[model samples]
Target chain A: MTFFGLFLLFFKIGVFTFGGGYAMIPLFFDELVTGRGLLTQPEFANLLSLAQMTPGPVGMNAATYAGFRQLGVWGAVAGTLGVMAPSLTLVLLVGIFMNRFQTNTYVRAVLDGIRPGTIGLVAAAVIFFAESSILRAPLQSLWTGEGKFGISLFGAAAFCFTFMVSKYLKWNILWIFLVTGSVGAALGYWGLI
Target chain B: MKQFQRLWPLCWEFGKISAVTVGGGVAMIPLIEEAFVDKRKFLSEEEMLDVVAVTQSVPGIIAVNMAVLTGYRAAGIAGAFAAAAGAAVPPFAAIVLVAAFFAGLGGNRAVDGMFLGVRSAVTALIFLAAIKLYRQTIKTKFSFLVAVTAFVLLGIFRVDAVSVILGAGVVGVVWMLLCRRKQKESGGGQ
Candidate 1:
């Protein structure tokens, strides 16, 4: 895609993303993976993990990394600007007409619908990440009975462990990533995974 | 000149915050509050809350939105640009550097394994985020319906997510209006 097209794609992603970074994932998968075929599922999942590890907004980090991979530094610039444009424009407008916009019934109604929808989108993102991350093959293989139903037991264990710690213990996210990554590396060195 | 003077400080403050915070935009909230409201005295407490509300309400990355709004309050439009640039540049530089490093390291088993683990952990994080959002967003039956419908369309049917989001909004408006109409009719009958 042209640089402008890249910008426009992210601009649309930015506009549709209501809740936050994770909310952008499903849209990112749809537009870049399925629609344009710019990134494979594994590549997308890898980028997301890197985005999470990095310091900044996950959406911005993902956009920058994806754009850089696709083009270069200029592509990164295009993606960043595209994602920020909507916020700059809309914030300015809201700043000017603050009270009315806050009180507007239509605005409230739209958000009411959009908020719940965002939950579903994030839920879908979980499956998208899981397909590419933990599962050795696509879950669809089970339904079609095409390839063997394979998985990385270590990866599944890591996922469950990570989920419990993050959900209940509230462990620092960066630490969790570092520890898991090191374990994976060591295990791989031993041919365990 | 006065606006320009505020630009660097605005940029520097936001850049500092973006450079350190992890997880995502929401994670940066307390630090932002600390920098602007408590330390620098740039905005009052009430104003900070307003900024948070507005940033969360609008569609975009929340970190950039917070920077723009707070920077505008500090200086002007130019300050907004300055803050946004500050907020954006660190991650851009960091990711570009990391991407370049990894690009050259292809076919390395160790790096591959590291990512494999990292990706699994990332999936778990996304799942946690979804659970938290479900608690926050799913309150009423209508909302539950919208959430379920959106999930089935996107997850199962492979329908595009953008259309599902927009469709949900239309459904919300119609449902709300119909409820209001029913209330009015009952009042008239009484």
Candidate 2:
């Protein structure tokens, strides 16, 4: 697709998705991987992990990285702007009108309702990430019932270890990522899998 | 001059935040609260919570949404753009550089190994985010049910997230209206 087409596509994605950037993963994977054939699963996985490691929002980072890969600097700009346009437009309207309707019952109700729904979407994202992170050959296993069914023991261990540290220890997450990532690399270097 | 002084610093503050914060908006909330509420005193804690609510309700990245909302409150449209741009600039530059570096690596073995670990941890981060949000949103049994059902539908069944979100909104509005009506009827009749 052309850069303008990419912009419109991201614009639609930005407007329709709720529950923040993670919630958009399913759609993003579908559009970029399945629909457009822009990125392979492994490349997308790398992009996702890198997107998290760097700053800014995942959605924006993904757009920038993917766009750059697709077209270069202009693709990056268009992709970023397209993803941002919907929020920019909506926040302005909400800013102007929210005070007046701040206490309105229906407004409150919708917001209230949307909150939990966001959780569910994030939960979906967890599974989405698992497809790349925890499982091996996720899409292939879905079709052929091959390598995807079982969790990679190492990945599961990493996930469980991270969860425990995050929930129980309350260490700074940045340090957690750094330490766990290093350990993983060492293990890999040693052929530990 | 005063406005410029105020807006520029606020923009820079968010820029600092964008540069440091990793793992997306979920990880950034505490940093945002610390900067905007504790250090800067630009927003009270309650106001910050409200910002969370409004930002969550809208579409887009929560970090950017927070920046826009908080910036607009601080200044106006220019402030909004400034904050948004400030927050965006660091990541834009960083991702490009990282991608360029990775492009040269040609799937280096050690690097890919490290990323494999990073991906699992990132999944854990996402799971943690859901747990944190669950505390806020899952108040009553109905909401609990809604959340669980939404999870099942989207996560397991692979239903469209947008459809589930919109559906839950409709259900919540109708549920609340019904409860309110029943309360009024019971009290008024008595």
Candidate 3:
């Protein structure tokens, strides 16, 4: 896609995205991974992790990085501008008409509806990342009789370990990444993965 | 000149906050509270709470939204742009540098394995975020149904996420209108 196409794609993603950065994942997956075939699943997964680990909004990070990967620095600018454009415009409008919009029943109803839906969207994003990271293949592969259906033992272990620690131990996410990444590199050194 | 003078501080405050915070937009909340409310005293506590409410209400990245509202309050429209640029540019630059670095390191086994592990961890993080959001938003039966339907549509049916979101909003409005009509009918009968 051309730079303008990239900008428009991200702008659309920005307009629909609710909740937060995590909520944007499924949208990114659908538009970029499935629809456009611009990014592979693994590449998308990596982008998610990198976006999380980096500074600033995950949505912006993902957009800029993904755009950079697709085109160049200019692509990054396009994607960043595209994603932020909606927010800048909408927020300014809201700011100007804050009193009326604040008490608007229709706005509340739409938000209430959208809020729960975002949970589902984020959950779907989990499945998307799981297929790329933990599972050897997409879950559909089992029923479709395509591609090997299995789990990467290392990946599963890392996933569970990270989940439990973050849930119970309240370990910081970045520390978890550092520890798991180190172990993974060591394992790779021994040709385990 | 006065508005231009306010712009730098707004940009610097948001820029520093965004540059240092990891784990995305939500993680920056406390720091933003500290910078704007506690430290700078630019926004009162109540105003900050309102900022949070408005930011979450709007679509798109939460950090940028927060920056826009807070900056608008601080220095009008120009302040909003300055703060947003501050919030967005650091991540943009940082990710660009990291992406370029990784691209150069392509096919390196160690890097691949590290990402493999990190990717798995990322999945777990996203799952936790979903659970947290579920706890926050999914309270009533209608909400539960909406969540389930959205999950099934997007995950199983592979429907476009944008469509599901818009459809859910439409569903919500219709549900609310129907409930109101039912109340009106019942009251009239009484």
Among all candidates shown, the one with the greatest TM-score: 3
Task: Residues B39-108, candidate 1: write the lDDT tens digits.
Answer: 8777899988888888877889989888988888878788888889899988988899988887787557
Position A39, candidate 2: lDDT: 90
Deviation (Å) of B11 in candidate 1: 0.5
User: Could you tally the backbone clashes for each prediction?
Assistant: 0, 0, 0
lDDT of 3 by residue, B59-168 (tens): 98888898999999878999999999889878988998999888787577888889889999988988898888889888899999999999999888889999999999
Give model 1's TM-score versus the native structure: 0.96
Error of 1 at A98 (Å): 1.7
Candidate 2 lDDT over A1-193, as tens digits, reads: 6889879878877876676777777667767876689998767777887887777888889888888888877888778888888778887678767666567788778867777777888787787777777887664467667773767787888899989998899867678778878987888788887
The iRMS of the candidates, in order, is 1.2, 2.2, 0.9
For candidate 3, write residues A1-193 as lDDT tens digits: 7899999999999999888898899999988999989999898888888898888889999999889988999899989999998889988889878879989989988888999999999999988999988998997887888999999999999999999999999999889999999998888877899
TM-score per candidate, chains pooled: 0.96, 0.87, 0.97
List the pairs of residues colliding in candidate 1: none
Between candidates 2 and 3, name the one with more favorable TM-score. Answer: 3
Residue-wise C-alpha lDDT for candidate 1, range A25-136, written one tens digit per residue: 9899999899989999988998888888888899999999888888888888888888888888887778767779888888888888888998989989988888876787
TM-score of chain B, per candidate? 0.93, 0.81, 0.95
| Per-residue accuracy of model 2 over B8-91 as CA lDDT, tens digit each | 767898899989877677667888788878987777888778777778767777788888888776677777888888888898
